[model samples]
Target: MVVSPERLAGAPHPLLEGLDAGRAAAPAAVVIFGASGDLTSRKLMPALQALMARQQLAPGTSIVGVGRSDLDHEDFRARMRRAVEQAGDVDERAWAELEGGFRYVSGGYDDGTTYKVLDEVVGDLDRERGTAGNRLHYLSTPPGVFADVVRRLGEVGLHRPALGGEFARVVIEKPFGRDLASAEALDAALHEVLDEDQLYRIDHYLGKETVQNVLALRFANSIFEPVWNRRYVDSVQITVAESEGVGHRAGFYEEAGALRDIVQNHLLQVLALTAMEPPVSMSPQGIRDEKVKALGAVDLLDAAEVSAEVVRARYRGGWVGGAEVPGYLDEDGVAPDSRTETYVAMRLRIDNWRWAGVPFYLRTGKRLPKRMTEVALQFSGVPHLPFAPTQAAELGPNALVLRIQPDEGITLRFGAKVPGQSFDVRSVSMDFSYGAAFLEEAPEAYERLLLDALHGDPTLFIRTDEVRQAWRIVQPLLDAWADDPAPPVDYDAGTWGPEEADRLLAADGRRWRRP
Candidate 1:
């Protein structure tokens, strides 16, 4: 658990100084519950390997993968090696070091005997390696099995640390729930097995470097905060767009539409971060308190409001990336008459003093034009313009954009005079790209999140109250859509979204950004 002074002395960046400040986590066992899933292979395993490569993992750390698959330890290791290879470039030495600690335990979710076997396996690791009774359980399984796994952990006394021992924490992946009632039920079940501090509800989007930079951009700089309120800002648009269809996930998509899969968790979380008041400090609870407040202040929509403010649609067969793709109904495992929505756009208002009059527009979709997630703050135009109308016709309102993916960066757009004697102006962007500014590529989101969980830092992880608040805001819309007999409107696969999405913004005299 002790931080290596030698390692800290060789730190390459100021942001990594925390590594030398005795903040590095102690050796522990990270037991993943759904080890056979794609999430484990694609993200979790690769992240663990990268952390080892960076010497971020403790010397005696171990990973025990628990799943229903019949694979033994060696079989699991081989599969993971291939996964890590596919993820990125791999260092043989680092991969070998991480592989040495890999183990697998095959078992069913509801079998109490399986947990008993797991308890024994974890104890053996504590004795063989210097894990010191510290364990991190990752619930990467389906939501239906979340409660069963938590209860089994509690039943086997795996939710708590051994007497006078180190820590025990659990990391739960989303979707946390399908609706408000389910979310509340899950929260209640979690409380029975583990204390609030011992649980980490992970949303990988929050783990991104750019998303974290949002807080830094707002609080660290003085220029934006003063004018960030309703008085100077016109409207805010947050978009999480993807160009690919559901593909293999069509079965899950059939039951959980875009609303449940994306808007309820990721999109709402981004909105809270964008609109929250500055925290007293950046402590775990300090940041979460402000986020909860912001979410609580969200203007909940009623049935009437839902019809006016929300637009839901499905993607029809059309060319994407210059290739034709199947519509939602044509996807395998999807019902012929499925009503699930692949695209969603909604307008929200915060009922707080700081953002009273301003609107926040949020949208997310699958099978769209491109893969990009960003937050755009469009500033109100100048009240008076001294320039001639013809000279300023091309000028648009100033905007500050925080791009979260693809080209991760911040862009400030403003009017600038063209190269001529005449007073002509055009919109220009001043860009700050992450890749250009830093020499090292940012760590994967899973890497950051896993390290934080091991270090017992929940600042980046969502809290129980935050989850419930997000569900509360989206539940009415879910109900309204369910009660209506009409199916979701349709849009082409390669297009941005349904025409109704445009109308949703046009009604307020605004337009959706081409991005």
Candidate 2:
């Protein structure tokens, strides 16, 4: 197992602590279902290359691309290499090491012939490359076909753990399902084919370094955890704002509006991470168990409360980041009368001892003011400010923000006395940047997650219960939106969300932090 100095630099994060943290991925057949898709070209290829560059993937491990495209192994490798090269400079030696094991099988996901062919290819790799029959199947295909892919693999006898305790695992991408019922059906289908332990439900947000650092900030450090509960924390804000419009994904965006697309997976996952109780240990199940519990504790809103608690809106044509963007309705392929929401803001109450009354405000929208993904905790104001009203008038509540992208870091806001001023106090932020703290830049989210998936570490991945619970929490809102006559409220692009969103906070005598 080779670990780049960049990853081993400084103190390792608490989440990264474990006996197997540095263990390389075992020799296995790494098969990707949608190997010709954009996710493969843009994300998966670069990530695999990075792992290869770091020598994290074991020598005998192989990648078998199973796609519908009619291309031989060499053509597939060339196409993927081009994408990896475009993403960044490739390590020629690592590329050579990885390229030899690359194979492609073109066939329909539902075709039994495809699985038989894939089985033969995998068997050959096991014998020739010493993969030892271990397999890691990544179902990168559309959610609609996930069950079929798994079932086909099962029919070909690829679902069972490989010989000699070598694992055979599958990774599935989300919108695990559109709603509660669909999610349950998908889970049942998957379970029928393979055990829960064999499936990895991936959400890239959980792979971010900052997102993982959240654990270190809470459980590893003593300062933050003490004030992390309802007694000291006033509110929690989780925002995943994107500056770009739907662009080429308007067709997909139309079907999975903000709630299903962002809220159900990314936002709720982050929320669970932020609010979850300290796990007894850093084991995969231990951490994921706490996350699932946190989501379960989120008070589900009734149909009646959905209207008041959740605000769904679409972005209208306007300037964003100084460039004009079209409205969601004007986006190509989007229906003119589409009620799909581009922005959603909701006030969630976690019904747990730790966060009983404290609100968790969640929001994610396309074409907002800027691209920012973060979780900010606003601590309650001081019990009593000793300074005169005029002295601390400008001071705001203390805040600890975990910035998940752009500039990945944490910022703690507090009040400070002004120098040479007469009894005046001002708010100040103390920042910790991942890039500055460590000499190396943090790996991209996909890179970290892909490495974890290959290593069979499911800590950063969503569990089955987590997915179903998230859908449960948001299902009422989904149904209410369907029954309502009015369309989603509209807000101009490049601005903050709709005015109604602001009022959502104002009604509680608080407001969202612009950051």
Candidate 3:
């Protein structure tokens, strides 16, 4: 069956619905630092290609790759071509169109001459390709060089837009800092070169179709909101688990651990979205303001509380996906005596009126039994059951689970009468899967975030205050963990996590959902 673009676009897909196909971005040049890095080939190039295929990119858009590699324009283009091909299938004409706009500048990040050359190259592209002097600089380099790249851009006048011209923006990758103080320092340095509006702190989680649908599932439907508060909700659990061990990120993971890498940014963002009040409007500031408020309401745990409420663990050698894998210490780049945590589970309380007494449980880890990310809200049981105790023994509290990955969907679990002469009730689920409900495939998270950066929409991107506030919420835990003399608890690679993780919820008279 031939499906029209209009039909496919307007279909009831969670991600594709309400997508504005006609919304055109202004002509701009994207300058990527460390363009030869894995992120560029694996994510950025493919995402840009996908955007081009959808006609979302403006005409005459250009891409400039900056790196220390000794590669000319054609070499970089060929490298990118292989990357895009590895990502997925590409139309020849689409590749050709994007290939035309590709350019390369080889230089060191610490050298001011590099930015000067970049300025000239960008200007030349502007004149030849009609890019209109608007630039979106992407710092795809390591955190150590982020400041250097930004300062160089400022020195070369690339951070400023042309007179009466379009805008200039920069997309910064995550791990904003090692801790609270460093995050503040990075923000200060960034503010010196660019205004807050010109900065886009990218957190890929916010761009997921399921993550964005969090807003729709709560606010768009009237029924869910009235009971969303602590009055009727029992608890909320957010889990991001990976079935595979850290393949080559051992060095990065050794320093970051699961808390700094995932919990501080991604899991916390999901928690805020799940608990935040409805925004006044859907504008970038409108949504972020509410998220900031929710994050600000999180109760900071003291050292004593941390010991009781938080669980940190490292993955020991065991089988995963039917294959035996080495432990974290066994990884190539990891230290044998490293105290880094591969898994973290914590119980949090939002001190706001909406969620005062309710607990928010969060957990994330690598080398788990499955790869899944979800937010589950368990509702309070009915106060008065009109049935016998035995008849309702199998019934459980109703839950609304929002599956963010794997099989993206929403599941509503409630009591359903078991078929018999008796009135016995059992838990049954009604699911809405993205694959089954929508014909259109969901766009990659990077594609959505990159397009937003080009269009100057900060809705999905983290703001300066949001970044600082997230750091603030996690600082106490980081401090406590740093001071503790005990090592992280150990769990087998293929297991869920440490036993302490289960005890975190067990202490509250509840348990985690296997999902």
Model 1, 247-356: lDDT tens per residue? 99988899999999999889989999999999866778878999999999999999999989999999999989999999989999999878899999999999999999
How well does candidate 3 match the true structure, expressed as C-alpha RMSD?
A: 4.0
> Residue 125 of candidate 2: its Cα lDDT?
91
Which regions of candidate 2 are displaced past 4 Å? 1-16, 161-165
Q: Report the Cα lDDT for residue 474, model 1.
A: 93
Which should have the higher lDDT, number 2 or number 3? 3
Clashes of 2: 0
Question: For model 1, what is the alpha-carbon lDDT of residue 219?
Answer: 74
Which window of ten consecutive residues has the lowest lDDT sum in model 1? 13-22
Residue 120 lDDT, candidate 2, scale 0-100: 92
Q: Candidate 3: which stretches are off by over 4 Å?
A: 1-22
